[model samples]
Target: MTCGRPMFPGSTTEDQLHLIFKVIGTPTDDTWPGIIYSEEFRGYNFPHYRPDPLINHAPRLDAEGLSLLAEFLQVGPTAQHFLMVAISEAVFESFGAAVQRLSDLSSLFEVSGISLHKNPGLRSSATLTGRSRQGR
Candidate 1:
């Protein structure tokens, strides 16, 4: 857990979804299959939001924690699981090496037809880590 508070603190389902979207951005057709078929969602037009940096919401986390959190927060279950395995194997690597491994994994996922935008948090995490380790 990055912060000691709930990530999405909305009491109602709709409100909670809005909160989630505020952080992770709205799901597109590529991200959510059959979403168009939902009558409830079909009538509602959700605002398009760019995914925010996890550090913006969870400033308590360090680069390593943010990197791990980013991997676990991928859109689809399969992507999340895949990254989980990769992250587990990366545990033995140094912080810089692990971040590089995650970047490589992101490239691999994209090459394998997974949308790169599906994991903006990872990109943001990597960027932040790079900035923190400037000149290293």
Candidate 2:
């Protein structure tokens, strides 16, 4: 759901992956800061209708986090070449279906350096790419 997701050009959802999270002390119902957004495309149709569940503060990596993540991916610990591009993104449900299938999710997470660690079960799930984890 996170990787391989692309948006239609000019789609209102495009480049919106790094959404602004609500401030920790802010009220849930409080109005947005009224920042100027590139005008919404009311007439536009995302013919491929999708739902949006934009979560705040999407998990990401800093230089340090990336080093940690890289070690987990086993592609190497100094693998800074990838995290800068993958770390920061909102990944709303809008992009899920188009990019989903058992294989893509596993592959994406592998690239993201998020294999199950510490969980005894993960030893197997680590090798179960292209398959959902639930069934195991």
Candidate 3:
């Protein structure tokens, strides 16, 4: 959403660490589950911080778009959506007429039981050679 440089940047590892503390703050069980159990987590040494709201990062987005963006930006592994389903949902949510046209097109092929996946390669070489002879 930000499309900006890293919130935490530094010349050295420790400097970056300090920047992370300043920007993202310390990760807790609630903010980042299982972070405390990670091998790299050091206890009580770094300063704590709370992140700014998502709205602050994407000031230009409208309320409806922001809500959808929030759903896609959710944390944790299980929060993820299937790529195709997410795209379809976004398209339908954002463009009603286009979604309807796509649905109509899909119904045209549904009766044939043939899928686009069945043809996976380029046009046959015979087709290419035939085209070359047509101009002769």
Ranking by TM-score: 1, 3, 2
User: Candidate order by lDDT, highest to lowest?
Assistant: 1, 3, 2
lDDT of 3 at 88: 63
Judged by TM-score, which candidate is best? Answer: 1
Query: What are the per-residue Cα lDDT tens digits for candidate 1 across 1-136?
Result: 2353567899987888788888887777777676656788766677887789989987867898777666666664366566647645554232344343456435423322222222254433322222223345
List TM-scores for all candidates, in order: 0.53, 0.18, 0.39
Candidate 3 TM-score versus the reference: 0.39
Task: Give the CA lDDT, 0 to 100, for residue 31 in model 2.
Answer: 26
Worst 10 residues of 3 by lDDT: 124-133
The clash count for each model shown is 0, 1, 1
| Candidate 3 local lDDT, 1-136, one digit each (tens) | 1222343458877677666555445667776688767766663356666655556655555787566655654444444444335546642333333333445235422422212221224332111111223344
lDDT of 2 by residue, 1-136 (tens): 1121222223334323212121122111122232123244323221332223222221333455444433333222233444433433332122333233424225544333233333344332222122333333
- What is candidate 2's CA lDDT for residue 28? 19
In angstroms, give how far residue 113 of model 2 lies from its true place.
Answer: 10
Task: Give each model's whole-structure lDDT.
Answer: 0.60, 0.30, 0.47
